[model samples]
Target chain A: MKIHGSISKTASFRTTNAVFIGRSIRLSLRNAEALIMAIMLPVMLMLLFTYVFGGSIDPSGNYVNYVVPGIILLCAGFGSSSTGVDVAHDMTNGIIDRFRTMPIQSLSVVTGHVVASLARNLLATAVVIGVALLVGFRPSANALEWLAAIGVISLFILTITWLFAAIGLVAGSPSAASGYGFILLFLPYLSSAFVPTSSMPSWLQGVAEHQPITPVIETIRGLLTGTPIHDSAWWAVGWCALILLLAILWSIVSFNRKAGRR
Target chain B: MRGNVIEVKGLRKKFGHQIVLDGIDLAVPTGTVYALLGPNGAGKTTLINIMSTLVAPDEGSVKIAGYDIVTDKNMVKRSISLTGQFAAVDEMLTGEENLRMICRLSGLTVAESNVRTVELLQHFDLTAAARKSVKTYSGGMRRRLDIAISLVISRPVLFLDEPTTGLDTISRRALWKIIDQLKERGITVFLTTQYLEEADQLADIITVIDEGRVVATGTAKELKSRVGGEVIELFNDKDDLIRTVSTTGSIHDIRQKLNELASIVSPELRVNIRKPSMDDVFLALTAKEMERSLS
Candidate 1:
């Protein structure tokens, strides 16, 4: 019968991930509406914050620089939110059953969505960054700092995409997963995405300062525009690493619980 | 291809307070089409889900292609291809892309994957729609693609959980022809269906379950014989059945039924004798089981 492959262990892992990642990427490209929204919404937000709110927030004309990192994270958030819906659809739909019956690690299914989310957000972030430049946002960072900024942004996307995947696994339906996605999308607003933590109401300052989004955004902002890094990078990487670990664990547990596979 | 390809013992599953499969047992011989027939809510899907390693049975031992479904789940999975009740095909991808996806997952090389995808799409009669998104497919086309995806690799066993549910008669017959081919390839197919004709036409052995319990298991003829003998029928001028007297196919019983029919006979009336079909077998056995449980 020459059944399913006798591929070596490492080769099988590579093939499983490549196949699923390729599947997710193809579907993402096919979804023109979501792809447009992922890029357009963030660019529009950057414009709004830079022109409409930028004047009132920062009269000195460099408000674009202040808001670019935040907009970048928001773009990533939007991209990852779609991943949640995707993961939920796969989990709740009958297609996952087909995958579960195959001789491969099912974790690849969730990771594919996460990786695709990373790739998508990177493109969206690039679009947002380009718009930021056109709107007069200036950065003093050299190549090394630019690389660090991209590193932080990527880790953040991976973290949140896996988080959404966990939510998708736990949600009963795609709509429900998106409902939770909407709630998580507001994370950027509560952080230092658009405003300074010091300028916010004193009582609200603690949350704006302590949340995962704040540290990652501050780290990206610091790397890009020469703001004080001052251990924010450590917190940024630490928080992302911790949440990524937890999200992976949560997704694996829930998927195993649901599919009854290891 | 002689011994059992699938073996289940003491299979039990419960969801909350409802029992789905209760102490069920069955064996499917290699290279045969084994049909599970039951009414709605008979736990057929749950049983298939367990065998395909999509869900763990609360209590049972299931072995597929010599691998334990629980402990050696991967081996069991490698041996089975499942087309669930739903089409389960990716609507976003074209029919050819979906086939290629499964081929890649099955670990085929790039050249082999392309050739296999083209072969499967053409064989499934999906070549014309191969480049179109699956969302554009009709119900029958989607079902055909679903089964084609399952056939991307040669597994020893295939599980189809209500594969033809909601399909039109023509679509169902088309799927039946595909199942017949799978049988010819010596793949042990386990499918669940509520349609008695599907069971009768396709199954080498038909097992009927009712309310989480197996009420009967045998060849179609064996189960029909269990319903026992023929029926003497009386029809009116409108072809309406007037009365039916069941017989054990004995000469004395035939004479007795004929005598009974003579009393109600008239010039405008007609008489006929009919053999019990799988439908009769199903109705009689399910009803008898229900009655037994109620008592």
Candidate 2:
């Protein structure tokens, strides 16, 4: 794969893709009611869990601290469903064909959807975190660790968003994108997210131990607890990297197939 | 040979066992409106898709604005825009936002996008409903907005696949005027239409496709001339009128004396010499295709 052209040309593709993604984010924000509604889901989840389920979970010390990171990660993961919906809406509405004929980069369309989800995810995450602090949740780690935590979660959300966008492209309708959302919500619940896997059934424990969500939740938990970083962080990063790569590959393949038929 | 902006040679496409376009060739010169006339499922959309670079050909090559569609895709895309049979516009966004987004996609800067959006809104006469969400707009308004978005990039070549499919007479004429203005700016317009008068009004050349192959290609007059100089339907009292018509060499037994005459003219002294319309030629060509297939 010769990238082709001079340095300026390479820079131009990145610039064009970024601008396109920025426009998508603006459009997403313009729908104020929908944006607010989407953000409310994660915040509501945090509040409900802290008030209702926090007493039962045993994670040493305050349950809010242990539960907050998991909820934030859940927000990042499930928040991407709307991105899939947007892409599906574009497909059903006949907008994708117009983009196919343009001079824009191939990845720009998927990136725009992913970035739009990222922007919304981050906003929702911030609202959830702020609400968490208000109700008594604090990280023992320093500023650098907090930033690192954010970086990991952002990457996680972006990767999942791309996968959902691909699923959205293949989905029959916008509402079906939310059907995938249910499966996303199941991951955090089944993993060692809100509770210890020791309390789970012997058969269920196998699932909680091996699922990708376990490592991700454990890694974020380790970071906020200021515990000595474990191999789980590396495992979480590796799993995210693999999923992102597969999703990127699948997106390009589906895009090409759609393009061929046009 | 005549500074053609689009040249398609032996183009072909297929979906599994179904062949869509089979060895069809066409050339459209710069600043000319070439109307591809076909009935439903006649592969007109497939041809436009291939030419617009939305779809790739199974065989043959397409050149648009002197750029090969496959090898020079970006350059080809830079010079052309397509409005397919379905008007593609975002219902959530206002008509103006749709146009502005297209400008941005075309690589216009922020300031340039604003200017282009305003210009397109005014040109499409969509300025009044510019702020209205497209979901609230009428079908005509949405269709008009779709076309206006295509122009924001100001490409030299434009493809419209049945632009006036389900429009009222008034809306159809409005679209025609916009197309005429585009041609005045020296844009090469390639369109496909089922409405015969549309091709008659707009096309410099018309190509008829049937069963995914070019059955006929020429100017409207050239094609019409092929059937006959004039068709005289007589309501004569004479039972021997058939003989009277047959002697003139212009009247062939269309129902029975089925020799295909390339061109016909009545040699009668009082011959009515009215030129045939494109509609008549199209009907004849498609009828022949049906007849051939049935046999």
Q: What is the lDDT of residue A26 in candidate 1?
A: 94
True contacts kept of each: 0.58, 0.38
lDDT of 2: 0.78
Off by over 4 Å in 2: A1-11, A57-61, A227-229, A260-262, B231-277
lDDT of 1 by residue, B143-224 (tens): 9999988888878898898989888999999999999988988888999999999999999999999989898999999988
lDDT (tens digit, per residue) of candidate 2 on B64-162:
878999899888877788887888787777898888777766766778778878877887789999998888997778789998887775677888989
**lDDT tens per residue, model 2, A69-157:** 78887888767878788777776655667777777775586788898888888888889889989988977878887888888888889
Candidate 2, residue A84: the lDDT equals 80
Docking quality category of candidate 1 according to DockQ thresholds: medium
Q: After best superposition, candidate 1 residue B263: deviation in angstroms? A: 6.7
Best by TM-score: 1
